[model samples]
Target: MYLGLDLGTSGLKAVLIDDDQQLLGEAMSALTVQRPHSGWSEQNPADWLVAAEEVMAALGVAHDLGAVQGIGLSGQMHGATLLDAAGDVLRPCMLWNDTRSHAEAAAMDADPKWRAISGNIVFPGFTAPKVEWVREHEPEIWSRIDKVLLPKDYLRYWLTGEAVSEMSDAAGTSWLDTGERDWSDALLAASGLSHEAMPRLVEGSHVSGHLRDDLAKRWGLKKGVIIAGGAGDNAAAAVGMGVVTPGQAFLSLGTSGVLFAASGAYQPDAPSAVHTFCHALPDTWHQMGVILACTDALNWYAQLVHSDAVTLTQGLGPLQAPSETLFLPYLGGERTPYNDAAARGAFLGLGHATNSSAGARAVLEGVSYAFADCHDALSSTGTQIGSLVAVGGGSKSAYWLELLATVLDMPIHVPEAGDFGGAFGAARLAQMAVTGGGASLATPPRTERTIAPRTDLQAAFAEGHARYKRSYHALKEAL
Candidate 1:
């Protein structure tokens, strides 16, 4: 048996997979995200460690822990976890959702070398800016920084006494040479930091370290269980969906939404809203579109407009024909296609006659419209995506999936076992590590279902999408 874990923003999930890729046991522990100030999101790194321990205990009771010979880890990307000289956490991890470094991000985005190396425009969510935020704001903590690690790499340090990160996760830090697969010396020098302050980079299939003997004993596992270098959550999800091939893409909607596609070469979109990162698969790359709000927009609308509604699932049944209302899903600043940090959400063309259901449906359409914008941007860059695979919490809603298909005018395939996506991808990597095979073991299992586009709704959606784009452009000047 092997263990695969995803250290997500809201929870820690551990899955036990046998050699045949069959799941034996699964466990998850919920966590809280703290917001001490506006546009700031933080989490305690120690909380993730505790969650891992709790889940491991649960897995120990369910399955024979001694049989678990390997471990793999996937995590929320771009979070900053700083450590002190003796390896103590310096402060709460500033998370990917945190937006406190907009000014620094702007400066970094303007630097020609940053663009030349990382192949990305800067954002507050990326690690380098967050590190600068700490240096400028909390000088005392910044002065004590001995090592800076991504969220998952920090967890691995606690588990295995080794500090390392894989290329896929490292690429999001805005301090990596995506093309050459190494630390960007130019970026490091500009940021007033050294490459020695970062963890060593390793391939996703390489053994990052062995489990610490004491911790391994505590969990009733073998002392030398090897931990495979894992990936960022989205990359792992891409691998889990079989997006390792260049032409395949996946659409995921959890708290945020992502559109990811694999590529053989580093292909970046001009104007640079989409991120080009090294893929978990060796010698490959992937591009992703990140929107800060997706399904969460629907949940927020459901709560505010329809508080009396019993369950969110009840809102999914067939309703009246689509309404004239349009929504802009910029509740938490969009990423892909629109890198506006100050942008706010809006409900256009609303009338007193509009019902709660209309508002709810508008939120769904708004997210789908964002997905459409991503597709358009990729197409403009000469990417030929044949299908978009849908997964994550939002994919379970038929109404949401149908809206995405209509808005994009393309089929959406739902891959099998998507709920365990990150974990499954991690397990697959560990499988390759144990067997020493690369791409031959990276393909995901078959998809479960496909939602074809409705030709009848295409024209209507095209008009809505055009209007949505126009609204965004008009609102940009005022924002």
Candidate 2:
């Protein structure tokens, strides 16, 4: 057996997988996301460790630790976890969703040398800007920062007594050379940071260290159990869904939505529309387009109307076509195709008869349209994506899946596994590390369901997609 751990924003998720890739047990422990002010997001480092330890104990109750071989760590990407000389957390981790360093990001992007070396534009959500944010706003805290770690690496340090990061996570920091796959001294100097302040880099599946005896006892694992270096959450999810091969893609709808595809060589889009990152697969690369507020809009609507899923979705029939009402779907600003962080979501062409069900359906359609835009961007840059596999919280919604099919005018398939994305990828990596073999990661065994494009909806989405493209243009001045 092997264990996989995901240190997510709101919780620590762990899964136990046997040698055959079958799941034995799973556990989760929830944490908090502190928002002291607007546009700020933070989480306690110790909270993740506590949650991981609890989940491990709960999972151990069902599966014996004696069979466990290796462990893998995965977590939210681009979150900067600052640490001091004694390995104590200097402050709450600055998360990826937080947009507090726009000035720093813009300044970094202004330099032609950055794009020449890193092959990507700077973003406030990335690590280097967060470093700069701390350096300027919180000088006292910045002075105490002896080292910086991403979210997953912070948890792995507690488990294995080592502070190391995998390339996939490091690639999101805006300080690594995407082509050469290491820290770029020029970029680091530009950001006013030192190379020694960053953690050591390793491949995603490389074994970083063994479980310390005290932590092993606390988590009911054998002393010296190997821990593999894990990738960022999305990369790990792509691997778990078997989207690690070129031309294959995965769609995730959680707090955000993303369309991701693996690549053999580094491919960065001009103007930095899509983000290029190292894949969880060794020596492979991938690109992603993120929808800032995918299901999050739905969540907000649920709160506003005071209705549950059962109540809201009761009378909704299959959408015959895209509605005339179009949604911008940018409650939290956009990344790909439009790099504006201040962009806000909107609903255009709403009429008097638009009900709660119509609002829900439009939200789904808007996200799909955004994905179609992403597809266009990829095509312009020469990525050959054939199929898209849906995962995360939205994969269970048949209605949303059907909408994606109509919007993309292609079939959408779901993996047999439900929502254990990054955790499952971590387990698979652990299995590979334990066996020391180059086994191919299994594709999502078979399609749970396939949704084909609805002919009637084609024209409506085409018009709506055109207007969707224009919505960003109209909102640009306001942003």
Candidate 3:
């Protein structure tokens, strides 16, 4: 048996799998994000631990955890979790969606060395700028910092009593030499950090450490069960779906929207705001165009109309022409093509005729348009994405999938319904860690069906997308 633990923004999920690679059992514990002020998002590290322990305990009640041979972890990337010399958390982790460090990010991004070495734009949510934010605003906390770990690595520290990070997670820190797959001294120095503040680096498929004896006994696991150096959430999802090679891609419509394409080599297009980060596997890289809001925008609109997302999406009869209404879906700023942290969402073309359904459809189309922007940005990098497998909570809506396919003019495959997410992918990594297998074990799940682009509406969507693009530039200042 093997175990996979995923620390997500909203919850922690634990999955158990037998040696044959079939899921035996799974459990989850709920979590909540704390936004104490505008433009900031945080989670208490203690909450993550509590949620993790709860899920593990629930799984233990039904499964034979003692037989587990390996463990793997996956989590949201770019969260800055500071630690003191005694290994105590200094504060709530600053999450990936937090944009309070925009000034620090902009100042660091102005230095060409950051892009030249890190192959990224040094966005406000990246770990380096968040650390810099603390330095400027909370110097006392900054001075006592002995190490900075990503969200998953902090969980790993508690599990194994060691601080280690893998490539996929570290690449987002703006302190990694992505091409060389190592920490960049120049970038670290520029961020007011050094190698000592960073954790030991490892490949995601390799064993980083063993579970601590006390925890192993408490959780009914065997002694010295290995822990794999797992991936950031997106990379882990790619691993789970077997999209590990060049030309393979996946579109994620979670709180944020992402278009991820695996690459055989390092290809940086920092100016385009396309993220070039390490893949979970060694000697591989990937490019991503991210939008800060997707389902988040839908949920916001749902609340505004006093209706749930499912009800709003279900009420729509059929896919119609693009609504006169246009939404910017930039509720919490944006990332790809325009790294504007002050950007906000807006609905253009609203009139007396506009109703709740039209607004909901506009929200969906706006997110699709944001993805179209992502597709174009990735295209500018000469990345060839033949098709994209759709994943995440928003993909549950057939209407949204069809609309997204039509907007992108690409086929979107939906895998047979199951838990092919970060936790499952982490389990695959655990299998690799124990068995010494690689991509062969990470096969793509069976495709239940494919959503092909609607050729009839291509021209209309093309025009709508053009207008959507124009609206951003015209109203960015006002919005």
Candidate 4:
């Protein structure tokens, strides 16, 4: 048996897979994010430990933990989890959706060399800017910091007593030279960090350390279980969905929206807000575009209307007509193509006659247009994205997926593995790690169904998107 763990912003998930590449057991424990100020998202690292322990114990009830030979991890990327010499968390993790570091991001982005080396315009969500923000705003904490680690690496330290991170998660720090697949000294210095602040780097399939003897005995497992270097959530999800090949891509509509595609070499359009990062694998890279909000917009609207997404979108008709209302899903500020951390969401053309259904569909359609914008920008990054796989809570909505397909004018593949998210990918990586990178030992995920675009609706969505673009810029200017 092998174990894969994912420490997500929403929860901790543990998956136990058999040697046959089948999921034998799985469990999850929910978590909460703290918002002390607007546009700021934080989570206590202690909560992650508690939740992870819950999930692992739950999984143990269903499977024999003693048989586990290896473990892998996956997590939300770019969170700043500062630590001291004794390996204690110094502050609540500043999450990827947090935009409090906008000024620092702007400072780094002003340098062309920073952009050229990192292959991304520094966004407040990336790890590097958060470090700069903390250094300037909380000098006391900064002075005490002995190491800075991403969220998953913090957990890895807890499980294995190892301070390490892999390439894919490290790339989000804006401290990595994407082409070289290594940390950039100049970028780290610009971000107020040195090489010493970072943990050692490894490929996702490489054995980074062994599980602690105490942890092994407590969990009914043997000591020396190999821990494989893991991946950022998006990359791990892609691995789960089998989006390893160049033409393969996927749209993740979680707390943030991500459009990701793998590449054989580094391909970047940093100046245009496309994210270029190393793939979890040793010899690959990926291009991605992120929008700060996606289904979270729907969730927001649901709360306002005192309804849920399923009820709000339940009987809404046809993809072509969402509503006269146009929503800009910049609730957490924008990313792809704009990188406007100060941008705010809006509802345009709302009429007294408009009902909740129309409003719900409008929120979804507007997000679809945002995704369309990301798709175009990613294509400009020189990757010819083929069919896109749809994952995340938002992808569960059939109505929303249809709108996305029409607006993007591309089919969206729904695979059985979508529900597993990154946890399954970590398990797959663990399997590969134990087997010495043997590709033939892994099983490809099965497709649930495909949602194809209606060419008729594409023209209508194009018209809607033009109006959305205009309203979006006008709103930004007004702000």
In model 4, where do residues sit more than 4 Å from their true spots?
317-320, 417-420, 440-444
Cα lDDT of model 4 by residue, 1-479, tens digit: 88889898889988888887678888989999899999899999999989888987897787779999899999999999999888888999999999999999998889898888988898988988898898899999998888999999999999999899999999999898888888899987876678898999999888888899998988899989999997999888878777777888888988788998888887778877988888888888888988888878888899999998778777676565657888888988888978999999999998998788878888998888998898888877677987688888888788888888888888888877534578888887887788888843223457788888887777778999999889988987786
The residue pairs that clash in candidate 3, if any, are none
Instruction: Report model 3's TM-score to 2 decimal places.
Output: 0.98
CA lDDT for candidate 4 = 0.86
Runs in model 2 lying further than 4 Å from the true structure: 270-272, 309-315, 417-420
* Model 2: per-residue Cα lDDT over 75-191, one tens digit each: 899999999989999988988877788788888888887777777778778888898999999999999988889999988887776788988899889988888888999988886
- Number of the top-ranking candidate, with TM-score as the measure: 3
Scored against the true structure, residue 148 in model 1 reaches a CA lDDT of 92
Clash pairs of candidate 2?
none
Top candidate when judged by lDDT against the true structure: 3
- Summarize candidate 1's per-residue lDDT along 1-479 as a digit string, tens digits: 87889998879999888887777889999988898987788999999999998999999887889988788889999999999989999999999878889888988888778878998878788999999999999999999998999999999999888779999999999999999989988899888888889899988887888999999889999879989898999988776666788788888888789988888898766375888999886798998878888876877787786563235546657633456888999886778887777777999899988788777778888888898888877777777887688888888887788778888888888777645478777877777776675434545557788887777878888888888899899888776
For candidate 4, the 10 contiguous residues with the lowest summed lDDT are: 438-447
Per-model TM-score, in order, reads 0.96, 0.96, 0.98, 0.97
Model 3 per-residue lDDT tens digits across residues 137-169: 999999999999999999999999999999999
| Per-residue error (Å), model 3, residue 88 | 0.8
